[model samples]
Target: MNKIFLFISFALISITTQAQEIKWMSFNEAVKAQKKNKKPIFIDVYTAWCGPCKILDKKTFSNPETAKFINDNYNAVKFDAEGNEEIVFNKMTYKNPGYKPERKNSRNAMHEFTGFLKIQGYPSMVVINNKGQIQKTIVGFKTSEELKKEL
Candidate 1:
């Protein structure tokens, strides 16, 4: 009976931990969701080859408290600055016209959306108000506590 109870406890703990995750959506989806729900959009502009960007994802975004806070306050988006996906924002279509598929994992052409945002570095956090205006742009890596405080 004690062993069964211990197993059940562990299972519940695992479920609780898994539930503390931020619901990340695309930029377009967040915009649409904003029209209905009116939540601020938090966009994580990162590149595949950026070391600090990877650390930001693993350390800051993976934290349970940070995830819960963001999930509650904002619509989160993970945007690849060097990716090939076409994004429509502010009534314009943005694309990485020179993107090379062969160099996807390495450095490639910067997406037009990234340029439109005027992002000069990796691991940039772009915060947009519920009314679709940019509130702030935070550059560089930030800890979970720092990110929470920023928001």
Candidate 2:
């Protein structure tokens, strides 16, 4: 019983860690990692209820080719456009205290990153250079090959 339990625990931990490798990370970590790897950072700005976001995660993000390419070339960050999380950029604080959930054009309307990247649609992907400058923002779904060309 003890051996079986240990095996199961290890299996669960492996699965959890595996999922983390595929998902996007935050800004600070991306910055630090870019210094070492010299690859661009990719940010996926999405919304909770965005259907296209789900599709991209499943169809584009989950692909083995996509995984290899992203892991090799970019530090991916996933940010929700409608979220109220406070983000600091270049010594400036971007927050929407009046951001009401599920509302159309409220006081806390959009995240600065979203506006900076000009994300017109959910699942929008923006590539930032090693110096943290905006490279380009790719909107909508992309096949593995389609995305590979951009990198």
Candidate 3:
């Protein structure tokens, strides 16, 4: 009977831990959501080949406390800096016209939106206010504690 109780308790704990994931959305979806409910936008701009970007995802964004705070206060977006997706912002359409599909997993053309934002490095965390204006841009990998303080 004690063994069964322990198993049930562990199962519940696992379920609760898995439920703390941050709700991530695309940039366009975040923008549209802001029309109904205004919230600051947190954009994680990363490239596939960036080592620090992967570390940031595993260490910082995956933290349960960090995920909860971001979900409660911001619309989080995961954007590929070199992706070919078309982005519409501030009455302009941005695209990666020079993006080569063959080089997708490696270094490729930068998205026009990335140039518009003037991002200088991978794993950049861009904070946009509820008014759709940039608040801050933090470059490189940050621990969960460090990222929480910034937010």
lDDT of 1 by residue, 57-81 (tens): 8999999999999998899999999
- Pairs of residues clashing in candidate 1: none
Q: TM-score winner among the candidates?
A: 1
Candidate 3 least-lDDT 10 residues: 14-23
Query: Can you rank all candidates by TM-score, best first?
Result: 1, 3, 2
In model 2, which range of ten residues has the least summed lDDT?
104-113
Higher-scoring candidate on TM-score, 1 or 2: 1
lDDT of 2 by residue, 39-90 (tens): 8888888777778788888888888668867887788888778777677766
Candidate 3 Cα errors over 4 Å, as ranges: 1-15
Flag regions of model 1 displaced more than 4 Å.
1-14
| Ranked by lDDT, top first | 1, 3, 2
Weakest lDDT window of 10 consecutive positions for candidate 1:
14-23
Question: Model 3 over residues 26-130: C-alpha lDDT tens digits?
Answer: 999999987777898899999999999999989888899998998989998999999988888879999999999999999999999998888999889999888
- Report the Cα lDDT for candidate 3: 0.90
Tell me how candidate 1 scores on lDDT.
0.91
